[model samples]
Target: MIDYLFRPQLLAVVFVVVLGLLYHRRQPKPSLPDLPWLNTKEGEWFTTLRARFRSTVNYKQSIHQAYDLYSKKNQSCIIGKLNGDEIVLPVSSINWIINQPESVLSADEPHKDVLQTDYTFVHPVVVDKPLHHETIRSELTRQLGALTMDIMDELGSAFDDIWGTNTTEWREICPFETLKLIIARTSNRVFVGLPLCRNKALLEHGIGFATAVPIASSLLKLFPDFLRPLAAVLIARPNRYHTKCFSRLVRPEIERRQKLLEGQNGDLEKKLGDPEPNDFLQWSIRRAQESPYPAERDPDIIAERLLAVNFAAIHTSTFSITNVIFDLVASNPSKKYLEQIREEASSIIAADNGVWTKSGLAKMYKTDSTLRESSRLGSFLGAGLMRQVVAPDGVTAPNGTFCPYGSCVAVPTSGVHNDPEHYPDAATYNPFRFSVERESSTAESPETENDKSNANITEEYIRKANLSFVSTSPTYHPFGHGRHACPGRFFAANELKLLLAYIVLNYEFEPLTERPESKWIGTSLVPPLTATVKVRRRKQNM
Candidate 1:
């Protein structure tokens, strides 16, 4: 019998049986590691895996459904195994991770590989050793305030020109095209300043830079880390294009300024600051001398940073603006919303001696509410406040469940924003929600008037609102959270508000389709591509 078992056929059969046993043993044995109170069945393991696969097809859709399940079950946390090694911790568990300090549960690990790709130009700057995060943050904060104030006239004028009453019929326009022009002009005005803003070749390069960098960065990300630097060099065309544009269009002006500074006495140069060193280039140059990465302070580097800002500003702003337009066109109720915003803008413009200031912008609370409402429903990100678990730690939710490291966690922003708990009858679009909250808060605490006012309408308010979703605190974050939250968001919010205000006040918009829903791919949510809207220029009563 022993001799027969050693035979080829017999050996083969025994080998197969042994392998099957080993494979079965290796298969993950799912357990309710977090649910100390409730016993979960073995079938739940398979259910979790199946759901994970389905959810992987489109994370946003799955997240929305997961929140609905969470709401119905009245559960703060749920646990599911994704494939063999991965796990799905409910939104609450993810929140716990976000709440923890950088020392305890670092975002550095999880997001390291996620953002290292070529598609993200700022990734290198962010991950580089010598570049201080605080320094960059401070500089950016100062730069944004100055930049926003400086470009108001140009931005306002661009709005007037693009949507001006000169055209009789509203031609079929590409929202992307219209938005690109606005973004390029606004960005150029701040980046290189005037004359270059009017440079046709430079503008074309700026527009193309937005599309190319993201594409290349995305491609670069898909490769291994060791290969990224090499890959960036390989995909150098966009960088080259940017360099060429900067060299040709911006370099001469910078050199002239440099010459002027060299010739002038210290006092005169300090007083004049190169006659007009008023844009991002000048700002970056001034700060770059103090930076460890002095090479990044170069005109090319300034161009790249400007390009990065544009990357952050353009698509997000356009998508948001387009969504608002879509929403206004689709909903019958939106006519009043549009009218309300127009009246607010008219009043503010009239009150401000025909000027739009930071204070004047604040008075358009209704418009702010409308945009906030639109973000609540039409937010494009699949998961808000996403973070990759870096440290070898676990997040224990309100239910005492722990989500381990290596897990990608996010706040169910769509869930929270649409949650009846937060916003009553959350599906309905209500512009008055924020405004009402502001009034109630003001009445309750008069001393907190400044707090309440700033809470509702400031750029910081919007940034905080978007970050709140991803934050452990759980307010409403459509953008993200923590130290790494979007820096260009202030500019994006103001740009969208101004553009929408301009349109609502001057044009009557009618959508060709009924309310259109957004389409989700993985974590990306894109609004309906081809919703036709008719625009009729409003007659000036004056």
Candidate 2:
């Protein structure tokens, strides 16, 4: 009887949902961007729900149609309903929308629904504070020069650990989880410092937390906002588990550092007779100590923030690496893509006495372009850089599309990136696409094919054409653009470049029969988890 009628909990949820539906009209359906609706109608309170369900069914088709319709109609943006709320998804004005003042188009507001961040294990300080981003953009980025060697060392160890003793034959591996493990360890080496990053328990807990977020967020969305607090208690157990693990593994170390601070009367490295830890934990601790808020200084709070950093760093970087690898095998059938990247990396590494430095990573134009192409095609979000309008009057775009207060707005990052207007032959995966293009729009002396035969232009030409992985432009926004662009991008770009260079030089992937397409739902773009590539260690490694 219970099975036929569904569990009591499920039945109760249905009853409450029906009640909420009866009252949902109290919520207003404000003006939209005037784009045509799909399977939609007037006076339908459930348009948002139906739209979301339809989107999930064939998201690529739906998004492509939306992009095309808006483009054909010459609209600035398209209005779409999602999860019972309206959103302004900008098409022509992506750059303008992303750069809008957060006071008007607030970035922090969207996560309340998307990630359920307020109710999850994510610390408010991590989300609200500017310090964490400052740490990434300034302090952590400054240390990357000194930290490169450590990252390379961890990278080698991670490869060995995951790939194992098999060296001779082609061994098929799951690019999905394998790449995550590689990126997780390498990133943690920088975030947590040695030993702990490799600790089975610590890595497990860290990866577990990140892997649990989307699941938790999705569950939280099943309930209406007023009931989410209760639902969060029941459904957010993974977050609780992650919080306990982070506190357990990391809080002790934070306390020890605090004791050291007290023992030395606040001279952390000076009195310890050693250099500072040169890791995120120590960096965060120092910054936390300087915070005006007492909550920011708490050890548990510090652990939560560190986990948040891990969450951001690992998810995007892992997909990026995985996508590029899949593209290397699946997209490049001629295998020239592999040879070019391998040659570039090999030549650079050989010049540096086999040490992959920050400078060395910079010169691999082909490898950098491969990652950029992957990012454009398979970035973490289909439409992101979301902002909520908080202004009493909301705001209007440069194109004069008004986003009302209490409504959400976003840019079609994927649409813009994939558009032929921004990139010629945007549908094709050309590994060296950015390598041949001008590095930036502002660059005065962009090299051209005509420069190829001019010996006088040699180094200058190479320099002009080479695109830095961190460079952001209005058209290319995997990391975003303007003031609020990703701060950790510098670290992320370098990490992935080095990691990819190593893979390119040391292994050859057996191409897949078809291109592995990424899955899209809501705004999230998930990589093909079932994708596999056959690879073998090169003679040098063997």
Candidate 3:
């Protein structure tokens, strides 16, 4: 019987049954530990039932609501039953948890399920050894940094192609589609480079891979823990289809480069001489060679890295760009802000003598502020800076509540960013708030109380002023913190800034909805999916 159970075919079945039994046995029993805050019989009974169900389906929202309730009551941390898991965390404990060393609290585990589902192929790439992560991160930074100019050039051309001058009518369009194309083009410029970026089939595959991975991840989350691994295996082939295409497409190029390097000074020196390769494939091949892994390792590892880059670049850039457009349409006041962005773009272009350089792209401060504000308001995830509890430790919440080890802590970014305490009149949309703050301060001047007051001048401003920028410590994270903060943030910002600048310079927009409210589902805040927006080319005064 033991031998039969150990067989590969029976192993998964047996494991599933054993896990289900364990889950059943571990289900919270009656006469649960008393939770101090639940004074009402109804509240206590509901809490007990929630513990028995062991579901996190509505847990995130419930946690937020609980924070508001208990926070007002002068309570810092609240112990609640989420699905079946016991959660004892303070609303203010994020800073403490994030500041702890990775050895004490690892981000690797909390995000493991999500990462494993959406990024199975790349798991080996990141977790194989320390060198793998370093190689990919370092190479990606170098490749993206060098490709900034190419990205800007492509943005200009792509803008003209999609919403060109000859089109006179203001048509209702999907911002997601427009942003999707822009991201696909820019990402492909780096991923495969040049001619392939223009290939419709390949571009479709790239976009499909980006969309599918997230959907797969969400679906995988619903299954039992043991079955998730099997589900990943079932879904991985579809995900790998794109990887297979990438490898086949780039293998010949890799071979040609290999020959050139072998014939001359050898591959290593050749790659080092021009370390900043425009093509991600070349960059990956060079880095893989330099990696500690033996050459005998499968070449698919390089393909996996390329796929990982595609996954990172496409979805994030697309979602952010879509959100910006949503805000533009929903908040019609954004038209004036768009015009300001246009003027900045026009000035930069003329100053550069009509040359689009990386420095010129960097000068679009208004565009940057607009994109940043949009991200602030239209944040895709509710929780910011997620870290897993590796070993237990004591964490003191901002409100002075204490949490023991093995507790997950998250920054209530939406709460912090939207709070009236930090930002007076917090609900109003002010696209230029950051720009105004920057303008008020000088290069060498210390931030005085007066300047800080101006920084939080409005009720809304006050709320957000105290909220951490990306440069702030891990506690106040929007793009995360520490070394693991989104490495592609600079690149993502540039792409969105350029795209928005082009649209503002070339087009005019009017909202379909009189008063558009962005929809918040789970942690993501999305603008109206089908909202109509009228657009037409800007009339030139010669």
> If the candidates were sorted by their lDDT against the true structure, best first, what order would they fall in?
2, 3, 1
Clashing pairs in 1: 117-221, 118-217, 118-221, 119-217, 119-218, 466-477, 469-477
Model 3: CA > 4 A from native: 1-63, 70-92, 127-146, 235-237, 263-276, 295-297, 332-335, 392-407, 440-476, 515-517, 539-542
In terms of lDDT, the poorest run of 10 residues in model 1 is 78-87
Cα error of candidate 2 at position 80, Å: 3.4
Q: If both were scored by lDDT, which would come out higher, candidate 1 or candidate 3?
A: 3
Residue by residue across 366-460, what tens digits does model 3's lDDT show?
66667767777666656566555555454445555544455554555566556666556767766765566543433322144577545435655
Deviating ranges (above 4 Å) for candidate 2: 1-19, 28-35, 38-52, 76-79, 82-92, 263-265, 437-467
Whole-model lDDT per candidate? 0.57, 0.74, 0.58
The number of the candidate with the highest TM-score is: 2
The residue-level lDDT of candidate 1 at 495 comes to 60
Error of 2 at 465 (Å): 7.9
lDDT of 1 at 479: 61
Q: Best to worst by TM-score, what's the order?
A: 2, 3, 1
Once model 3 is optimally superposed onto the true structure by TM-score, how far is the C-alpha of residue 115 displaced, in angstroms?
3.4
